[model samples]
Target: MQDIPELENCRLCEWQCGVNRLEGELGVCRIGRPKVASAVLHPAPPQSYTIFLSGCNFRCLGCQNWSIAHFPDTNETPRGYVEPECLGEEAYDVVNSREGKFLGADRIFFSGGSPTPSLPYVEQVVREARKIGDIKVNYDTNGFLTVDSLKRVIEFTDSITFDIKAYHDDVHRALTGAPVEPVLRNARYLAENAREKLWEFRILLIPKISVGEIKPLVDYISGIDPTLPLNFLAFRPNFVLENYKGASKELMEKAVRMAKEGGLENVDWSGRVGLPGRLSEKTSDKYENKGGEIAGGIAKEAGCVTHPRNCVACELEHECPIKNYRPAKKSI
Candidate 1:
């Protein structure tokens, strides 16, 4: 594997820890070299060969793909260090295969724990893949990237599926273990500047957990441009929130209505609904926001030692129990 010299002073995401990833110094993401957890020919919209990258910058409590997201901390053995050119060529072949065409596949999707941590590697892969053929590329992101990093993403990706976990700072922090400002900022940047490349702004509605975020989030997005595509994802119980109730069909419908009412012209909802589970009794009175309190409580129960869940600033950044948490339940 070739070294990214920039990894010597890595500042790929908002954390900007400046750690030498090549020399094994860890940052909030804790990934040194980018590794592929897996790759599959997915049948979802914008269907393509989905490349799951290992490791993430956020310690999201209800992470559906926790094993891949937590990576080294979670005992996940990734397909360690495929040469960028090799993986890129593989992605090209996979997306252009007969199986890919039968599934309506049209692009190579780069998803992860969150792709921000592996931006350089992804960029390199795109370069190599495009060299093989005119392969379209889609980037699925958590929207926690820095301004410069987001710019690079927009430059390379044919389309982007951006995730906005929550709108309010407190709720966002508690849910994702990171601040919401950067994510919102990046979302705004995309909507205002690169709307054509944005596939959609995906908001996962986790019943009581993220219900409150819809109105404010819709307002924020519509305020920028009501025509910007927005999708409400029905959250399933997973990771630390494994026992938490999944979003109901009624709630998903209501979310779409709420977004449309809030002036979002292109609003819709999707995902499996109503898988059985109970809401968490654990909750913190520390946060002013109800959603934050609930999510913060779950994070606490899962051994996250920080209130407000600032993983980048927390003393346990390297030794984070949330990153190493082994959930008893796996929703999938």
Candidate 2:
């Protein structure tokens, strides 16, 4: 934050791996350099020119972008390496595109395996982008940054989409391969010091590991300030959890209720469905799966088919959870 010049002992993320990234030493991310995976105009919420960087500190079983996030030991030539200035310029052009300038795209989102590992590069991009024209930066983070790095992030970025995977430390470790302290610290820091820059705190509602975590997380945030915004991302079956069905509308409703009862305000999730029946029963009816879970057809009828993490430009994006969640008439 003040002047983290060399990567001799990288303490960028919460891992504190202490590996010398400058000397070809790799940390848990398995990447020693700033290698990006892809960049595109994403229309998730307010559309953003999202940049995805390679490597992550967490090894989540439900990683949606595992293909890029977890890089295998391959002999092929590596790609997706771009200078920070070029990326910043490209983002500036996309946000100010002539054909449709006002379609709610106003920010350049730094996403990844997690942005913590690319603090220097991302900050440079933010600076370069702002130099060209008025630009806004949003960090889609896992909230594992150190206090100093977070201070620098607050100095530059306009808003942050902070992630809180689990509330309990043991459950958090079991789910994400990381402790819950750093995320909790950063979230509390933002709520207390930089509330204006805090866009929202997000939690992925995993079926067994994290569904029950919603209440504790809500209570923690309520302890800080119930007015802080929280978004519950219904878990999409991905990677190791592929066979499992996504979090049901009923479960998330209970989550919402708990949060509201805990005195939280502004609670919303990604796509809404169901008519009082639980995800395990009734809804599937004639077309139940062999395991009695929600089948593809039933999910399609309800609006989501266990959404993929990044569903940009897909034909059926209208029904995807990452893009939209149509609430029931009563809830609306």
Candidate 3:
């Protein structure tokens, strides 16, 4: 373990916890060694096996995978320890298997707990896997890794699925227990240097908690490259934020509209489209103008089908004017 290329004083993420993980010391990310929570063949995005690593650099209050991300590093056996050679061999077999090829599961995704903690191990897996098949690797990250680590990651992975939690420093720290500047730095660096390999950016709108984070976040990413695939995910209340309601369809639609207004060319959203308020994203479905016919009366008067009461909080409220309307008029 001491011989592994672990940072003497860890500087993997912006936290710079500097705890020397090679000696089996824990930092805020809380993993002394590279540990994986689970590995499953995800039959989506052209099929891939997703390795969910344990421990996260940022302790997000609303994290859905807290059990895994915030788990104790006491027993690595539960959190499987697959060395590069064996893990890579398994991955190669999985991808090249008849079932894998038929199902289009030709890639591997290294996800987290923010993959930053397990980056060295992940890279090793990528190297070993390539020996068997030229398997593409998708690195799913929270965008908090240091610029140097990100460059090394880009060397092995084919694409990145990055997450942007918020734009400002204070809000980000309050929400994720980390500052936002490091995320922004890595984002811009990736855009400037590895733009083509940036597969997509994922943003979660945490209803009342993080509604304020969407616009500025969108503006910054749009500035970098509007063509970059930006996906807005609806937040499901979980972990510390379990009491709060999930995001709404109306909220997501407003978000989509704002993203378009911010000059983002490739924009989309995922989650269920249910009633006007307090909707849940647990229902997996693409966004649709399902509320188009339901728009009328209050909805028409507010120039929105949802007629959401959080007007001041909504960045798009100014785009619509209040006016008396005839019946059956629906504004999407």
Candidate 4:
């Protein structure tokens, strides 16, 4: 696949500002030139394991990593870039270190503000990681990539955790500053083609903003496959909308019910288990809460108890949230 020419005039993301990202041109996503932020061997909860990339495609009003996503003008800009080979090397090291040192990780995840915006860079990273071993590679994405872009990277990915913001185009646009059409299209395409691969749909049930839109979003997902796992995240205000309140438990339950009523067979809550204050502590509380819920909820729904028995012997125990939770005796 050829590098998107738009990468040079990068409107790949929601910002759609035709900025030259390859020539060190910074667009709304803030990543200039090459692959920016990268971390290997991180323990992402509920989702198991993965690598994280920086930069984003959307200018979410309540973005958590505003520093990275919005590219704060005050901080020193990152100048270094990690090549795909270097990324692969780092991933290999992480896998080896985890296995040799008894770190309990079984998967690799590619996450970002919107990873599809940097398909070429991510493809390079995934291709290299695949060379090391047969690790399950997953993409945690916003479901905004064009079909052509999705086709290019879909083969390299083993699973996808796709975020569906809202069912209606207007609501989706209002919430994320991007249209819902592309997201919906990609979701349907992935469901049909990537069904054998674990394809989970996530929705953030924002208090006032997203509640009414739940039925439509759930209806759309149900039409694809009622058995597809639909995750509902409780919204917390942070980043740009610090004053916005977190979704009430009652509201979250209502959204979950909406999904079930829409004929969705597999549904789970990716919202806060019980902590209200934890949302305020994070930079992008809403985004963090959404991500945490997706990771945690999906893991629990998969039959791995909140506190997996294997977690006790893991070296990264201190950092593992999955082990910290009291086991839910009932299945989600």
Q: 119-190 in candidate 4: lDDT tens per residue?
A: 777777777877877666778888777677777657887778888877765455434545567888888888
Better model by TM-score, 1 or 2? 1
Evaluate residue 182 in candidate 1 and report its C-alpha lDDT on the 0 to 100 scale.
Answer: 96
lDDT per residue for candidate 1 within 229-331, as digits (tens), equals 9999999988888888889999999999999899989999999999899988889876778899999998888888888889988989999988888889766
**What are the TM-scores, per candidate, against the unseen true structure?**
0.98, 0.78, 0.79, 0.73
Model 1 alpha-carbon miss at residue 252, Å = 0.7
Candidate 1, run of 10 with poorest lDDT: 323-332
Alpha-carbon RMSD, each predicted model: 0.9, 10.7, 12.8, 13.1
Model 4 TM-score (2 dp):
0.73
In model 2, pairs of residues that clash are: 271-325
- Per-residue lDDT for 187-290 in model 3, tens only? 88988899988888888886654577778888898888888888888876555444446678888999999999999999989865442334332211111112
lDDT of each: 0.90, 0.69, 0.68, 0.59
**Regions more than 4 Å wrong, model 2:** 1-5, 72-79, 99-102, 271-332
Q: What is candidate 2's local distance difference test score?
A: 0.69
Model 4 error, position 34 (Å): 3.1
Scored against the true structure, residue 71 in model 2 reaches a CA lDDT of 48
Q: Write down the TM-score for model 2.
A: 0.78
